[model samples]
Target: MDTGRKQNLKEARTLQIWNVIYDIIEVVVSLIAGFTANSSALIGWGLDSTIEVISAGTLGWRLHGEIKGLDERRVERRKMITLYVIAISFALICVFISYDSISKLISKETASWSTVGIVILIISLAVNPILIYYKRKYGHKLDSPALLADAKDTFICLYQTVVVLIGLLLVKWLGWWWADPVAALLIVPYAAKEGWEAFSKAQRIKNNIDRK
Candidate 1:
């Protein structure tokens, strides 16, 4: 094997492991913060992180794993089907979030301050963009769709941070209670659009090898 190929494989493996750890930790923390503050945007964004976890899992398993023969494509196809199900799960979560945010907006929900969670998100916002640039740089070099997907997920965190920041700012500066959920509502479309693209890509990959 080429040294470059070996390096890419190592990078991919390292990235996948970090991704799994990052998503698991961050999403759990975000959910805790979102609920603690009753912030729709925060919670909605947390759900998005959960979806990314599924995407990363699929990317790692398929992109790095082995398929020895044509017969094994069936197994790979089944695994990809599972990934597609993850995509469906993302859509369902998005719908629920959109509905919840809208309902909260109409009902005049209050978004409180979670000092710790906000601090956590602030750090996440600071760190993610750099990672994305790096991931895209490498993913593009290797033509690794998995890394591309992970890069997108990292960028989504930046977007979610902006949305959450809006809500937080409105609450902090203007005392506008509705602005938080509204900001979250605005980002739902972003989440949906990205997830749809990822789902389509996964479906394409699966369909290419799926005999059934």
Candidate 2:
């Protein structure tokens, strides 16, 4: 590998490591706040964060293999697997969020206002854009589709942060009890779209591998 390629891989791996750490904290804090406030949207977001950890780890592993001079076939195989995993994970997240949101809507559950949830989301709003920018930049630098897909997932999380924050605010201030679940429901279509895109990319990779 050339010097530039090696440097890009190293930087990408470092970014993924930071992503994993941030997501682990997000998972714990969001879940705690979700349960405390009885907010389904917050819970769904927390679950999504869990998948982000897996996505980052998968890409990180792929980058590591490249840095270690793994065989071409093995690296490609790992890339294909990473895409498949990301696709399936997004599908699962869509299903879970859909079910939970609809149930909450039907039951007319009103989540309590959580100061912690608001604080965490505010922090995320500030942080996710930086992550997204670099992830995309390095993803392109390394020419890694899996990394690009992971960046898209991070973008989804940023979108969810905005939507969830709005929902929580409406619930707290305007007595819009249904807003939270509805906000969560809105995430479903986008998640499904990303999932399908990932799956399609994986299929293409599989076909290429088969031809070789």
Candidate 3:
């Protein structure tokens, strides 16, 4: 393999490892924040992180076994499996959040919990964009759609964090109970978009300019 390809794979492997760590951390944080705030969106966010952990693990394992471009039947199967699992997981989370948020909206209850959630939101907002940019850099360098899709998902996470933060602040200050559920509702489109991206990854790769 060329030196450039070698370097690219190495970077992809490292990025996958980082993603694993980040996802684990995210799941933990979101779980705590969700329960504390009684926010279904936050709980659903935790579920998404768990799926990311699976996706990152699969990517890392697949990348580790590859010398360059992967052609083995097992590796290809693993990638496809990972893609399906993540796609299903994203859809599930989106549906759960939508249902939960709508219920909350109808009941008209404000979310409460965690000055710490706001703090977590601030940190995620600060960190995710840079990680996503690097993920995109590695994706372009490596011609890897999984990495790019994961980056896009992280941006959604960032957007959710911002929305949740706004919701929390409004609930705290304006006494707008609806703000919290509204914030959760705002995430639906992004969640579905991420789900579609996960589902489309391999198909998109297959339908390349050369294939078409």
Off by over 4 Å in 1: 66-79, 210-212
**Lowest lDDT 10-residue stretch of candidate 2:** 142-151
TM-score of 2: 0.94
**Candidate 1 accuracy as TM-score:** 0.86
Question: What lDDT does the true structure give each of the candidates?
Answer: 0.75, 0.89, 0.76
Report RMSD (Å) for each prediction in the order shown: 2.8, 1.4, 3.2
Model 1: pairs clashing at backbone N, Cα or C within 3 Å: none
lDDT (tens digit, per residue) of candidate 2 on 47-157: 888878888898899899999999988888888898798789889989989988888888999999999999889999998999999988997887777777777788989
Best-to-worst order by TM-score is: 2, 1, 3
**Candidate with best lDDT:** 2
- Candidate 1 structure quality by residue, lDDT tens digits, 2-116: 6776677667767766777888888899899889899888888788778767766666665555322235675467456656766687788779788988898889988897786
Query: After superposition, which runs of candidate 3 have C-alpha atoms over 4 Å from their true positions?
Result: 68-73, 202-212
In order of appearance, the predictions have TM-scores of: 0.86, 0.94, 0.85
Where does candidate 1 have its weakest 10-residue lDDT segment? 62-71
CA lDDT, candidate 3, residue 115: 68
